[model samples]
Target chain A: MGELLRPEEWTALRLSLLVATTATAASLVPGIAVAYLLARGRFWGKALLDTLVHLPLILPPVVTGYLLLIWLGRRGPVGSFLADQFGIVLSFRWTGAALACAIMGFPLLVRAIRLSIEAVDGKLEEAAGTLGASRAWVFAAVTLPLILPGIIAGMILSFAKAMGEFGATITFVSNIPGETQTLPSAIYTFTQVPGGEAGAMRLTIVSVLVSMAALVASELLARGIARRLAA
Target chain B: MKEGLTVDLDHRQGSFRLQAAFDAPPGVTALFGRSGSGKTTLANIVAGLVRPDRGRVSVGGTLLIDTNSGVALPRHRRRIGYVFQEARLFPHLSVRQNLLFGRWFAPRAEAGAEFGSILDLLGLGQLLARRPAGLSGGEKQRVAIGRALLAKPRLLLMDEPLASLDEARKAEILPFLERLRDDTRVPIVYVSHSLPEVVRLADTVVVLDEGRVTAAGAAGEILSRLDLFALSGPREAGAVLAARVLRHDPAFGLTTLGTPAGEIHVPQTTVAVGSTLRVQVHARDVMVSLTRPDRVSALNILAGTVAEIGNTLAGESSLTVRLDCSGAPLLARLTRKSVAELGLSVGMPIFAVVKSVAFETSHRPPAVREG
Candidate 1:
């Protein structure tokens, strides 16, 4: 493993994994809540909320990143408030890159989970409720188990998107080596100079291996859950 | 202890409106109606799934809902078990897991101490490890029933649990349902469009039609009244006799049933001897005579006194006459001309001749009798 890539390349690879995992884990609960609301809730402003959730998907990634920077930058409104109140920072840091990746992947996560929630039979939830399960318990037991496959699919999709999230991440947090620089940033840096083809190719191969492993893991998990759920 | 149910509710969805009120005093009180007659809506209201516009629902005098004072309880806290038309067993759970899903919520004092007996009662002992997807329709319904029973509910609401099954599957599950009704001793509100199911399972019957309650009374009395049958089944007005199988004549393929009316024989049934069941005698199949016809070809003759005469509308030739055969109610559809020729009066003694094969009787399986 040491001979395959230098120290900088390894840091970029590890940083990319860290960013993607954080983004995926951070968005899971809110993503599911929004997806269920869109699928089953009847309320005002639902259409606007839906469109806003999908804005990252349809909008250019740079614009999403720019908007995020405008609102969450050090001098920006939320950024300044968070910095003063909590002594935390996100701009130009790895955390900002993770935020950008999460925003970029959120639409995929919400869409996948929403589709599964729609496919689930609401009557089953009602059955659990009548069987003495509270509303929260019903969701945890019946709704969560039934939608396990969809949640896994969403996670895989979001992870893939986060892994390749170049435009938003780069715009929000510039290519700072050993700081915000992830695999994509490192590969771009390698390709910008002469005699850098080998390094760039190596990192690209690493990216492919990471994504393929995630895909295969998702497949196995989905099949195992399906088998357990069926006879 | 058998806790009775009382409900008086009014609700409307779109253009459909429902107004119903009835009392269910233990055993199975069937909501007998046709497909769109609002039986399911009433059940949903009682179970807290549907909120009625105005109503009062109480189980064993404990108020569950009272729109007058906003005393409605949520569905999860109602402690009422429901077996839907389709067995909505959780696909992700094993049979044992499904059975215990609601058992956790029951109070500690009632948390299914009879769990092993219930599994035996539903024949689910061997299926504990299996999931629901591969089970047959009958097996799935049995599991559903067992799951609801394990909840230790004060009352059970079954909305045609056998409606989705085929005839053979219905026959397969009917005996188990009978056993559940008997052994569990839970007051059940059974909803169905099938008349035979009502006669076989219902102790008290509440008849609904076009979103209105036409009548509610003891099952035998409500069923014997021709006017009540006209609400849903106009032509099936008959008597429901509580009979027990005495013996079987295997040589002639016949079974002897001892009813309060007299000894009656019918086509051989698979039900075991000494099993008690309701036997339905159709009005169209009866031929009444003033004196005993010695040379009649009919195999059964019941001695009775004409108790009541149905109203004969102008220009209508046929009317119904009810007979009290030793306290057993029997209905006979006779022509106005026949009544006038024989001078049939309320006290006149008559003989009701019915062919043995015309008895539309219920055939319970053998397993339901002794166990």
Candidate 2:
């Protein structure tokens, strides 16, 4: 494993890990909030919100990346406002890659979490409220713990999706050697050259191993949560 | 008007409409009804979980809801503890955490021996560390009760806390409930479809039928009303009497109870002397006779005057006769044939025979003064 990976391959692998981690961590809170809202909120425009969240999954990956670029580009309306207000830029940067990955993986994250939140017994939350817990307290103390498995599942799904993201990441934040290039982008770059089969094969193997490790870790976490809930 | 509960509410859910208003004295006030009879809905309104379309609910002078003033308290702010039928304990938390979940939100001033006494009273001291998944139905309910009590609620609402348990589990929890009502002095509004449970626990009984209050009074008076027997199935017709333990006869394995009417001997009970016990004698288990019969195996024979005679309803084979045994109320279910043969009528003297060991007893702990 050590000898076959060149320095550039190592960079891609490390970059992939960093981008996936950032994407997963950044989306965690918003995903949970959206999931809970979708699961429990009874309001107008709920269906529209649901459709918007799931649009990335139904649209082509390139189309999603293009949409993100149109809205979040340096000269774009949102992009210029964000850059002027917060001095933050996303276009052609590793953060853009993470953003691309996050948008691409959001549907899976929210879907898993929403299902789990829906599965939680609302009656238990009512019981908590009657016990003198306010609405926020009920959510934190009762609903959060009950939906931990869903959160874990959502995080893992988003992480795996972010790691494997290629089309959206390349379109939104083009592949840069040590910056925006994730594992799939790096493998695609290697496959384009004549003598790059071996490198591509090695990176492909690393990608598979990382994805497997993520899935196994998620399984362990979900199982642990289930055991605790059952206990 | 005094220290009690007053509820006047009107609500509509789909096709069914509920309009009820009553004042319950401080004690265990039972909301008695069958399924879809709006008993649970009434309990939820009292707890501030369900809002009525128009009404005012006040417990011990604290206004929970007054639609006239547009004042409605949220459930958490109501400070009324509710024990649900399913217990509804948090599956993710241990029993200890579940019990303390309410304490964290309860006002500190209301906190005192409520926590320790509830833990002790419900016998939840041992299973604190166990998760709710590991608890039996009865144990979970006990924990649920403890959790509610620790909230230091002024009024406790129990929505059929034992309806989900089997007979054995219910038997296991009933005594704890009796002790809770007697010891805590927290006015409890218990919702139950089972007449036996109502008779066993409630000091005041409010009978509901089709989303209306058909009867409301003391348990003894409500249970003795033969007119309400048609509402609650005839099998549930019975009389509840307040009696004190007279003596425990070790020789014949009998315990004598002294009611206002007469002395009743039953299979020996472990209750201590001089403790007040509510005894429920089902009307069906009682036999009516004109003259005092000799050589009868039944241990209870009370001389009484027929207070009221209810005619047989359509398609009914039996008639209900309300008897006033001295000062205590007794109910006897006699067949139409027997009623005619014995010539039973209002104000006529009669003898009611009850089989020993047929009475259900609810033992109350000696009342403790509340601050």
Candidate 3:
């Protein structure tokens, strides 16, 4: 299998896994927090926050990538500060691919979690409060556990989306083999060159298999959680 | 009242207004009312789940909320345990874990209610390893109760905990509740609409009508008021008597009760001899006789003088007659036509014929004998 495809293809697959895992991990807490706010918070600008969270889903991926580039580019406000103060570079790198993927997949992550939070009975939280749980304690003990399946599903969706991310990632960080070139970018690169049909087809098969595995894992995790809750 | 709970609050939500003030004398004060009368709202105010627009609430002399002074404790800090109508158990938690959830949050100074004894009390010994979803309705309520009690709360508030259960399930949990009241020292505020629940459980009764407390006093005194039931519902108004079990006539499946008035024969009860049972004699079930009528199917009869004949209550065709049999107070709901035909006056002699089966359900140990 290692000899069948070039090491560059293997590098792309590994980079894709790293970018997707990093994106899912980095955004998980913030995703859950935003979802909780959307589901339960009644503060001012709630609608605006909700819309902001969902903007990446509604906007074109290229447009979102362009906006991220403008805001996080070397000469941009946040980018210059990070470059000068922390000496960390994101432009035209694998980390840039992860950032683009995270932003694009965030909306799906938040939506699933938000729906689960909304489905939770407020009465149980109230009951927990009466049992002497503080607000934070109640959320940690009751709300968090009850929304585990939703969080898992959201993470899987984000991971899968990050694994296959193309337009946003390519726009933000150009496809560089072994760097920013993820599974989709590798497949796209292979299809563009001559006699690259076999390579493209091989990468496409791996992508499909990866997505199927993710879907199976999500189903199994959700069912296990549901069974535990029911038991 | 003793070292119990006191609440005086006024709150208005849209068109509804709640003006309630009552001293709950410790052992299971039942907040009695119809669905819309704000019984749950009042209970919520006490538990600090709902902030009263203006009022003071204190338990065991500790002021939980005093809107006038701007002294308010959050529900969690108030050390209150509320058992909701629904069990509200954590679906993800095992029965043992759910019971221990409150134990985790209990104050450091608070002594934990021993888990073993509480599990034993609620009959949850076999259920510790099981999850809440696997429990029956009655078993869930029992676990809910254990969860609340394990908090070692200063005050326990039950908001119609049995309301969501069927009659059989309600019956199953009621004995555990009675045992909870009898064995536990936690002061309880029990909110319920069912008359039998109040009669069987409450020491103090607070009657609510349209968001206002209409009457508040000892359970026996408040519950016996014919006028009080006219507003809540007249179908349940009656005399609440404390009668001791003299002996059981097992051959006929009957038990004889020795009341302050006379010997009363009731249908079989499982209570042992000498236990003081609360007997709720429904006013409608008591037939009045001017003379000693013989061969009546009703097995219990007590001769007494008419204490007071209430005027015809509004929207009801019947007048309530109060019978004073020695020191015991019995109520009889007679129509105006019967009042006139029997020539029943405040001082007239009468025979109160009580249907024996009425006592079948009336023989539970209510908290307060005087109430």
Question: Considering only chain A, what is the TM-score of each predicted structure?
Answer: 0.98, 0.97, 0.97
lDDT tens readout by residue for model 2, A1-231: 357788999899999999999999999999999998999899999999999999999999999999888999999899999999999999899999999999889999999999988898889999999999999999999889888888899999999999999888999889999989899999998899999998999998898899899999999998898889887
Point out the worst 10-residue segment of candidate 2 chain A by lDDT. Answer: A1-10
> DockQ for each candidate?
0.83, 0.84, 0.84
lDDT of 1 by residue, B184-281 (tens): 77888999988878888899999998888999999988889867655545467788999999999999999999999999999999878988888999
Regions of model 2 farther than 4 Å from truth? B292-297, B363-371
The better-scoring model by TM-score among 1 and 2 is 2
Model 2, first chain, TM-score of: 0.97
Better candidate number, 1 or 3, judged by TM-score: 3
Question: What interface Cα RMSD is found for model 1?
Answer: 0.8
Ranking by TM-score: 2, 3, 1
TM-score, chain B only, every model? 0.89, 0.95, 0.93
TM-score for all models, in order of appearance:
0.93, 0.95, 0.95
Clash pairs, model 1 backbone: none
Model 3: lDDT equals 0.87
Worst 10-residue stretch by lDDT in candidate 3 chain A? A1-10
- Candidate lDDT scores, in order, read 0.89, 0.89, 0.87
Best-to-worst ranking by DockQ: 3, 2, 1
